[model samples]
Target: MQPQLLTVPAQSGPTEAVPAVRPVRFAGLRLVHAALRRDLARLPNALRLLQPGDEPGAEALRRHWDFLTAMLTCHHEQEDRRLWPLLRRFAPELRLLVNWLEDDHHNLDHSFTRTTTLMRIATRDPASAWSVAYAVEDLAARLETHLRIEEEQVLPVMTSLFAPQSRVGTLGELLDLLRLADGPGAPDALAWLLEGVAPEQIEALIAECDDLTARQWPHWQAVYARCSAELWGPAATVE
Candidate 1:
């Protein structure tokens, strides 16, 4: 199933007062979450497939590992540096839950480091693939639990903050606080979100972009198609 890049909680509350929902307003965050979830679940099986010394496949997985960690680090850094701090200021009641999530992020590091190490070894020694698979599966399990909590507890508060009556943070301010803007790999990162999404849905997302991004839509797709093909084989190509 394709993730809905943009989100409105089952209830929009006051945001409905706005004329339209821009993808940047909420979709950027959800897209990052979706991409993380997708890769965590996928990496274990992908590693298992390379147990027979498939060096090219292993290298592809390694590049993707770099992407996954980069995204995860940025997401956590922003949440810790920006998003949680905002919640701390405005939604004091959520402090305990937010703290737990923050701690969870730090606690996952041991397994993350182990998985990263195993991934590098697997690239050279086929026998190490199982080790990588096990490590990733464990990491995925922990991350899934973390994401479930965030989606259930944190996101609703975020959604409410977008309401018209909320004085603390407007959507634009929240987006800025989260620092969802482009940095290194910005194009590929945006392109990463659209992979495997339905064509019509992709068009809908692009429609909400600003003029410059709307113009660059084709190039993003081409880049994603190439990346997908390399990571998952020819079968994964958009064509």
Candidate 2:
């Protein structure tokens, strides 16, 4: 007797083949690049909120803070779990860089915590907003520099060392982490990243989600839609 091949029903809606999972080296760099752009764009708006006014800037600042905190935390977690171990295995010479990166993460966390505390204070006492704004600005500058160092010095080494199989596993790990960390405001943060990416990069990201489940699809769509509208005005739309 011939064995019958079991077939699953196709999901409804726009579906595309999932691209090969991004390489670990490339994925790390892309994630950081996307995140940095979002934070930089929002920094000005957040700073503006500190200005003495009855305007709705406070809400904006709070939202920006929430987004940044979540993104940075998730980024660091991915590095700690996926990136660092692979680096230790592939390029042991770069252990120093990993150490430095870890230290920088701690330093960045301190700055973020300080900024968050001050922002909370400013909520009730608008007079204190300037101090919080200054801290946030300083942190943003530091983070930008840190990202550049990782991109230039660290990622290339990783790209050279990680095997293709490892890269696929690492990419899967990253996606799992992001899904686990997704909160009420995650879509907004993702939207912020999406808006800053070039057209081609946007297509790449969509391609990354090609195999996403039917349930996960609508959540992402809603997130992309709402975030685009809020951050980029009416021009924001998923392509």
Candidate 3:
């Protein structure tokens, strides 16, 4: 699916269409914040499974590890391609933060790889799981801190620095970049956003995404449906 470039709305005209929800640009960042929160909340459960002599817990840890690997890797990749470059251009004073984020991405990737490798070994050789679990705990701690910093500092900067129209454009670029990197999960991430957002906010997101290719819409819709079912069950209705 090709990502459509966002159209710049008139800056000063009162006659311009008032967006139905929060602009996609800000909505996207809020989505990321929610995801980070969700993942962090799951860390303790993951860590408990890693305790020594807990075979069942070890298996549980492995499951969480796989989920985190997929989610965090996708998140970091999207930021590297879409958010960082634009931040560099629009907020050069934030260069340090961007660089640190990039470094953290590498750190996270390394930790995930290491933890995955250990998980495979531990699955086959139970004694090995404890060692891997300790490493994962460390990684989770770092990740939690990183998430807090990004949410508290980075997101606010993004909200304040970018114009509404430019923010929407950047969001389109970010989504497109993620689609290239993670395929359907890019939209899955979008669906994840819907959980934390108000209905009105989602309407705005859908409008912004409408700027993209028609093909992308199906992918995003599928993601929303899947996540809604998984997160909220069959009874959940998506606006």
Candidate 4:
């Protein structure tokens, strides 16, 4: 069940009597999730392209993997610290589901850690790239499941919880906080999330974000473009 990445709000079906999951913020999430799904879907092949003892190639991939995981960690922490707590507080009935999603984040982190370890090993011994590739594939599969659950079950609840009249800060506020929080991979994170997004949408999203992102958008895009093409090769679409 692929979540369509669009600004148009779509109903995820209500968990109780909540708003439909149609908000700009949710669109931002869907965009990020879409980028994750598309890129990771192709990651195994990219990993496989590394030749044995190709230290340069393995190191390059390791750098790219580190960037990706840094962004992933930031996203996971946002959900864990902010989103999940609100859910547990307001919707006690969905505690079991919330717990599962929270567990997924932690478990996914462990899996990501394993992949990082393998990436380091591959950097030294490129023959181990095969193992790293399989590890990524496993994480990608789990992520597919996790993202689907978030869309299917959590969306409606979140939509209701963060309704317009609610006193809680908007997604933009949280993003602003994240930007100022000295978060890891901030520029790279924006670049990664903006992948495959339209130029206009990128502009709009950046407007909702920070001046730093707006000012550095082009540079971020350029860096990511070069790094991604070098890592994933011509077969992969750089944008």
TM-score, predicted candidate 1 vs. hidden true structure: 0.80
- Tens-digit per-residue lDDT, 101-208, candidate 3: 999889878877876787677765665645655765676677778878886778788878877667533445546656777443555556644554455545555665
* 2 versus 4: better lDDT goes to: 4
List, residue by residue over 1-239, the lDDT tens digit for candidate 4: 23444354455566545432233546556655776787677767767776776767777777777777766776777678777788889988789998888888889988889878887876777666677778878889989899899888887777777865452334354455457665655666666666766655666667666676678878888887877777766544335
Q: Lowest summed lDDT over 10 consecutive residues: which window, candidate 3?
A: 1-10
- What digit string (tens of lDDT, one per residue) describes model 1 on residues 154-238? 8788887756444222222333433454433556665776677666656766665556667987887787788777667777666
- Kindly give the stretch of ten consecutive residues in candidate 2 with the minimal lDDT sum: 1-10
Which run of 10 residues does model 1 get worst, by summed lDDT?
Answer: 166-175
Report the Cα lDDT for residue 51, model 2: 53
Clash-forming residue pairs, model 4: none
Q: Which stretches of candidate 2 lie over 4 Å from their true place?
A: 1-25, 49-57, 164-172, 181-189, 213-239
Angstrom error of the Cα, residue 201, model 2: value is 2.6
Once model 2 is optimally superposed onto the true structure by TM-score, how far is the C-alpha of residue 155 displaced, in angstroms?
0.6
Candidate 3: segments with Cα more than 4 A from true spot: 1-25, 43-67, 121-138, 168-171, 182-187, 196-200, 211-239
How many pairs of residues collide in each model? 0, 0, 0, 0
Off by over 4 Å in 1: 6-25, 51-53, 164-183
Instruction: Please give the lDDT score at residue 177 for candidate 1.
Output: 37
Q: What is the TM-score of each candidate against the true structure?
A: 0.80, 0.71, 0.61, 0.79
Query: lDDT of each model, Cα atoms only?
Result: 0.69, 0.60, 0.61, 0.70
Estimate, for each residue in 86-115, the C-alpha lDDT of model 2 and write its tens digit.
777778898898988988888888878877
